[model samples]
Target: MKKSLIALAVLAASGASFAQSSVQIDGIMDAGFQSIDYKGNKVNGIGNNGSATSQINFRGTEDLGGGLKANFRVETDWNTVSNKGNTGSASTPVVAGNETVAAASTFGNGEIRAGLAGGFGAIDAGVVNYNTLGTYLTGQPFGTAIGSGFRTFYVNDAQSTSQVRSDNSVKYTSPSFNGFNASLYYAAKQTKAVDTANTVTNSVTTAYGVKQTSFGGLGAYDMQGTTEVGVNYANGPLAASFSSLKQDFKDVGTGTTDQTVNTLGANYAFGDAKLFGLYQTNKTNTSSVNNKAFSISGTYTMGAVVLMAQAGELKNDVNSTKSKLVALGADYNLSKRTAVYFRAESIDDKAGTVQAALTPATIKGADTKFARTAIGIRHAF
Candidate 1:
């Protein structure tokens, strides 16, 4: 009788454990129509991610006694127009211009991670989204949407710089203390490809004599280790953030170099209006390639509508030229989970033929200037 009771007790405990675990499904659906005019040439099409990146997310968590918990997330992104899964490679920089070169479909390409959480905060390992200067993190009025102007001035992953999502990475987030918290991340080293003669080598050399190999559109495929650190503080109506990333690189033979980027941003709310400001600096060590960017944005909320405007500039010290961006837009909330928006943005760049945000195939010449107007709808669940 005692043995039978012991078996029953074990089964009861197992059922209780299972009851403590939970799983859910959630995601965003956003799509829009865009009319782009470049150097007097116009084109119209449907675009994805106008207001927010559309994605499907599956999340699960389990209580592990005490104050600990285990969790995992699987997310996948897709282009609404093509109905193809996004591989999250659109952020990788190229020598020509921002191009759509990812595979037609990929699974779990967005922020897949598994980790634990407790009083110490959380630690996760996987392909992690580590972009600290992105629109959401910086409190950009348009949230990196069509006319945010954030992308024109600052790029999270630009050839020798940082990446939006660091693969093969481990990240640790600290528990909040007095409205302040921090994150530390590290990505393992990767094998780099050496340049061979006669090969279509699309490389860039900083003034300091460092060269980066971009085997024709495969810039992020091979690289060294990467490190990123960031901190954020939120209290009442004021919020601030700062982040720094260092990426190491290697060249043919035994030469190595590194790139670093630093960003600082803050936002403040005043009644029905809010203001945001951001400053960033990037440098390729020893190359004397110093780039600086800054932007200021503001938004006013009235009833169910929010209006946004932003202006920014990118000073490319390497080429002794500057690129400018101006954006205006508004979002109208249809409900708590749905929104309709419109954006009009323009960018002017004469320094480099390749603008990271514009499609190279669509752009005409080295000196590029363009304007885009878009209307979109978003739904979240």
Candidate 2:
């Protein structure tokens, strides 16, 4: 009889512990039709991620004692049109000169993190999104979607190396204190190389933006990883943020050069309208060139419709190069989790290299200009 009683007690304790944990599944599905005119090469297609990246997410949390919690999140990028993963490039390739210009792939694990949280803050380790891309997501009216000014410019050189998504990373986010918080992120060294026998790997280029050829017969290369810091403030109708990111690149024979970027962003809400602004500067020790970019955007909401407009400029100070953009769009909410969106955008690059958001291609030494139009539906759950 005592054994039966003890078994019953144990089962009850297990049930109670299980009740303290919960898991949820959620995702977004977005698709659209887009027509892009890349100065003479025109293309139209059914597109994915026209308004938002389609993704599925699994998130869970377990409440522990002493005001603590254990949390985890896993996200995967999905392509609604193809029923496969995101291809991370234009479905139709653009031809510029004799080269086929294809956008670099932006597909990743999204984010997979597990960590503990308490009154002090939360710490997680895994593949994570760095805070330096605040303008791409937070400070822009389009939020990295089609027609986003920053996405059109920053996708090329600003974040080509490693400021967006990082692997083998650890991050800490402080608890909000009176509308202010801070974050720190670090990623360990990521290395890739050919065998020592193949000392001359030709013009092998690394993710850290370096090319080398058997420098002193080393036949090895590595990225020194990244360190980033961010601070943000949000209260009432105002939100502002600042971030600094540094990445080191090392080649077998070329030594190392440090690349750094600093960004500042802010947004203010005025009744039914909000105004956003962002400014960023990037530089590398290997080159004497410096790049700067700034954008201003605004949004107005009325009933079930939201209208947005944005303008931005990117400049290379050393070469007197400039790229300009203007975008206008609107979204009509069909329901709480469903909406239809429309966008029209234009970009002009005379002597610069700034690709459009949907069509990531640019002509060199020639007038690279394009106009894009898109209409899509987005559903979330």
* RMSD per model, one decimal: 7.8, 8.1
lDDT of 2 by residue, 114-229 (tens): 89999989999876667776634556778666677644555412334223555567899999999999999987544454322222236763332233211112223233567889
Best by lDDT: 1
lDDT of 1 at 34: 86
For each candidate in the order shown, give its overall lDDT on alpha carbons: 0.69, 0.68
Clashing pairs in 2: none
The estimated TM-scores of all candidates read 0.81, 0.80
lDDT of 1 by residue, 137-207 (tens): 56577665576554556666434223366656789999999999999988765444443233333684333
lDDT for model 1, please.
Answer: 0.69
**Deviation from native of the Cα of residue 157 in model 1, angstroms:** 3.3
